[model samples]
Target: MKEKKSMIEEEKEDHLKSTKRIEMEEQLANPDEEPQEVISEKEEY
Candidate 1:
């Protein structure tokens, strides 16, 4: 049971890393179309 739990944890970590990597790659592949000012305005002042 402990071994299975460890495996599950590792898998979850791997999935998270993979997702973040993909997101970063996509961002790099395509330049952001939105302006920084617009983004800042939408966020907290």
Candidate 2:
């Protein structure tokens, strides 16, 4: 039972890591676009 719990925890950690990696990649891919998005949000306000 402990082994199964550990495996589930590891899977959750891996999923979180993967999502962080994806967000990092997106930021890297659109380093300029992010500023534009922020600017648009400010303009809306």
TM-scores of the candidates are 0.67, 0.66
Give Cα distance to truth, residue 40, candidate 2, Å: 15
Once model 1 is optimally superposed onto the true structure by TM-score, how far is the C-alpha of residue 4 displaced, in angstroms? 0.2
| lDDT of the candidates, in the order given | 0.71, 0.79
Candidate 2: global Cα-lDDT?
A: 0.79
What lDDT, from 0 to 1, does candidate 1 have? 0.71
Q: Candidate 1's residue-wise lDDT over 1-45, tens digit each? A: 999999999999999999677656655665664344344565766
Compared with the true structure, model 2 gives a TM-score of 0.66
Query: For this target, which candidate reaches the highest lDDT against the unseen true structure?
Result: 2
Cα lDDT for residue 1, candidate 2:
100
How well is each residue in 1-45 modelled by candidate 2, as lDDT tens digits? 999999999999999999678667766887876745654775899
Q: Per model, how many backbone clashes are there?
A: 0, 0
| Residue 34's lDDT in candidate 2 | 73
